[model samples]
Target: MTVIVVLAMIFALLALRLFSVLGRRTGHEQQQIPAPADDRPAGARMPAGEQQDGRTPAQRAAESAVAVPAQAGLRALIAADRSFDVAQFLSGARAAYGMILEAFWKGDRETLKSLCDADVYAAFDAAITERESAGLTLDNKLVRIDTANIVDARVDDGVAHVAVHFEADLSAVTRDSSGAVVAGSLDDAVSTIETWTFSRDLRSRDPNWQLTETDEG
Candidate 1:
């Protein structure tokens, strides 16, 4: 009878030890594992006040504007053109700068016509014509464009005008009919800076902007 009691007591102690190590639910512990991360698309996960890109609407709007202090003119311009995006505009301007320069040198009038305003196209055409009349040819290549920045923006009478400052490296040579280099260096790269103004009519259906004016700096 004593051995049986001893064995019972030993079993009770062992059970108590196991329970202590394993722990028991006290009706206060977390009952379920956390739900797996939502596998829905990003846009479906959060709908209100958030953009598809995970930013709040206000945050996205702020990012779309130019990274400068609020100018009355620029703000007004944005108000007038609801679809205007400063980042996208600057990117397109950079590409246009290179394209225009190459087209001008190669006498590609059709390309220039599409990119420039009427007056600007006339000026480019006259220069190309004169070069051809003088029996001179220009060999120019855009080595690289270093920077393109928006220096000013404004809207006038439904016309939006923006000025972009461009700094680029180029290799160019103007040669006469005798093949003698008259200007620029073919072997050396030259750094050039120019500010070009682009304009678009808000009332027009065309989404394209045209180069209206240019200034060398």
Candidate 2:
């Protein structure tokens, strides 16, 4: 009976020691879990699809364009086309603006036809014809685009339209058929503000947007 009691006491001590070591191990493991990393910064509102700066990638894309007024329309566009990128679209718009201006100045109706809608193309074609009839040619250059911002956007009847306000410096000169400058000078750059609306059919397979309307801003 004494031997049995001694063996039982030894077993109890072993169990207590094992439990003590396990408790220490658990506390040590807890310390390894990073605290500050799991905790969000104070007063930060992190909505879904937003980053630490509190804006989504789409919003950031429109930052150069000041997108507050066009946010609702932009949202509608994004909802319709999941692959649409605002930044990429803005970049493309800038390029198109330059190309269209150059084409119109040089009377390249082919390029204008591809970039503009029927009505827009007709207007440019008429202007080009008039210039050719008058024996006048435009030697215009797009100096630089100062600003390009999406002022409005919407999707209607499966069509998406975005209006962009553009401020640019252009060097324009009109020359006679004999290669003599008739008006304007390349030394002076003219600052012009214009609004161009681009449209695309969401239901169509073609991803290109055409200039649908234009106005002076």
Candidate 3:
């Protein structure tokens, strides 16, 4: 019975020591473990220069608000074909009138060549050549030009036409028969209202719109 008690005590001591060693090993393992790194949050990241889907914000905006060249052409056709812009028509007439007046004053053949019709050019060239042959020179001193009215600006059978009334103050110089300069002075400035007609001359081949006639009063 004594030997049995001594064996039972030895078993209890062994169990207590084993339990203590297990507890110490578990504490040592926990202390040796490394800490977790602080990187970022959970979900995927959005890349730079890119929106939610794929395209950049600027690219998406440009795609939405862009004006295509074809659309611009269509808009121009609608504005021009639906109704003639009276202001634009008159602006063109004013330009043609200025071209003729300034071309005459400057004796610029190129400007006259571009604006005048063939018949009109023939008339003007004949007079100019005559003056040249006669040893005479001419100068037009223009003071002012007043545009009085735009009589008609219309589109007929795909042809756009506009007529305007213009008045100008002019001073002309005419030399006498002698080779020397004579009778060279500014004349009494007069205002004449001329009804000049013009046709639409868009930038294209066959762009020249011949002046049909003129009425001076």
Candidate 4:
């Protein structure tokens, strides 16, 4: 019985020592997890679609254009129109895209006349007249333009022509006189890609570039 008691005491001491060496973990203990390294300044929140290299998609595209350099055609265009700026032209093209679409939908011929060349205006007018004769009206909304990039540029006989590629989302519907939907859907937003060419005479006094042609891209 004495031996048994001695053994029990030794075992108890060993158990107590083990517990002391490895303290009990309370539920309130803080977890130790390595934090991810952030190169951005403290309190900086990353912008949407921004990379760790600090370049956005648009920025990357612009950098690529610069690295590749302008083609011979674009160089000629720049030479013909000394005041032309590719960046500014693209910005204006984006605005013109939305404006032209909206004007066509509203059948605003006068507005279209101001923005488009004679051929484009005639085409737009004919479409509007046909729709009117058929007692149909178009309701269109430009949801958003995802991207607009210069796809082609050239100068021909002092005429500077630029083709801009655009990707956009639109909501459109055509209604008949009875108010029934004839085409497209108001609830459905369609994604479309188009290449629109704008031209201007470099020597002409008028500063506006007119829409010369449009094609599905």
Candidate 5:
């Protein structure tokens, strides 16, 4: 009878120890799991209000790179590269749009070469060459960028590509060799919508993105 009582107490102590160990392990596992999905990447620092609720800086920038509800591609991109930020990207894209357009219009091959990939630069070069052959010059100006939004984003094979939809007003003028206006009017700014895709190698240390593709939105 005493042996049976002793065995029962021993089993109770072992069960209590097992339960305590399991509880501690479960809590540790939960801590290892990350918080819910957040659009903001890990590296960049933000102002006080910007980090609230895991919301991205895009929310404050008024242009969400992940789209309003977020897409699978954008999510995948964030997963692949934690440093990607839609807001900063959109800002840089706006500047690049203006710079690339002005360079193409001015026949600034050096600028285009630096900002564009090989294919895009080649296309721009061809157009510039054709224009020069025809003895024409362009005086184009980017009036203002009304909106630039990220429409799509993806990471594939360690390369990241992001598509931005831009709406802007531009004034373009074409002049003949004699410097007489031949085409387009600089007085009238025309609204244009275009989608441009930019790409960067995630593994590369360079943060700059190259213009890869362009199309009418």
Candidate 6:
């Protein structure tokens, strides 16, 4: 009976040792396992706002040459090398025209310097000059510009072809050679659509598109 009791106590100790060994082995196995890497390719999706790309945010911004333009402006007007937006272009042009005309009326040289191309500047400046010489002033300003559509808008070899319908109401007064005041009257608020063609001059760093011609109807 004492031998049986001794054998049972030995079995209990062996079982406890086995359980301790298993627990230690489990911990060691866990330690041997490697941590997962976070790096991944662009195609591989990561969690939100996480960038797996090797490039730094600044590097990515610099490397990315294309911009998805949301506003109509000079950059959107002619700086684009890819597909151009006609609506954006026309809207920008009309906005530019309004500002430029306002500048001319106010004799703001800096505004004209920024917005108008050389020839466009020359024409506008000449008009202002002639009006000044004749003691005439712009009575009513460009209040509205209604653009129908760009019938043609295509880009080729760093050049874009755009023909747009422009309709606007502009009013100004002119004096006859006689020293008599012609009572100002609205001139029928004329309705004429013009299809203007523009071409880029490669020589200038501005790469500004200029009016090539106009088809008036």
Best by lDDT: 2
Q: Provide the global lDDT of candidate 5 against the true structure.
A: 0.72
- In order of TM-score, best first, we have 2, 5, 4, 1, 3, 6
Q: Per-residue lDDT of 175-196 in model 6, one digit per residue for the tens?
A: 4446344544456354446665
Worst 10-residue lDDT window for candidate 5 reads 23-32
**Candidate 2, position 194, lDDT:** 99
What are the models' TM-scores?
0.67, 0.74, 0.50, 0.68, 0.72, 0.45
- The digit string of per-residue lDDT tens for model 5 on 69-115 reads 33566657756766554554566677778878988998989878978
Worst 10 residues of 2 by lDDT: 26-35
Rate residue 178 of model 5 by lDDT: 96
Per-residue error at 74 for model 4, in Å? 2.0
Residue-pair clash count for candidate 6? 0
lDDT of 1 by residue, 1-217 (tens): 9999999678645533432222122344321111123534545575486544455555444343333542445557667765565555665677678768878998989878978999999999999999999999998899988877667778888998878778899998999999899999978999999989988888987667889999998
- Which segments of candidate 4 are over 4 A away from where they belong? 1-70
Q: After TM-score superposition, what is the CA distance of residue 34 in candidate 5 from its true location, in Å?
A: 12
- Return the top candidate by TM-score: 2
Stretches of candidate 1 off by over 4 Å are 1-70, 178-180
Residue 56 of model 4 has an lDDT of 58
Please, what is the whole-model Cα lDDT of each candidate in the order they appear? 0.71, 0.76, 0.50, 0.71, 0.72, 0.47
For model 6, where is the 10-residue window of minimal lDDT? 26-35
Predicted structure 1, TM vs. truth = 0.67
Clashes of each: 0, 0, 0, 0, 0, 0
TM-score, candidate number 6 = 0.45
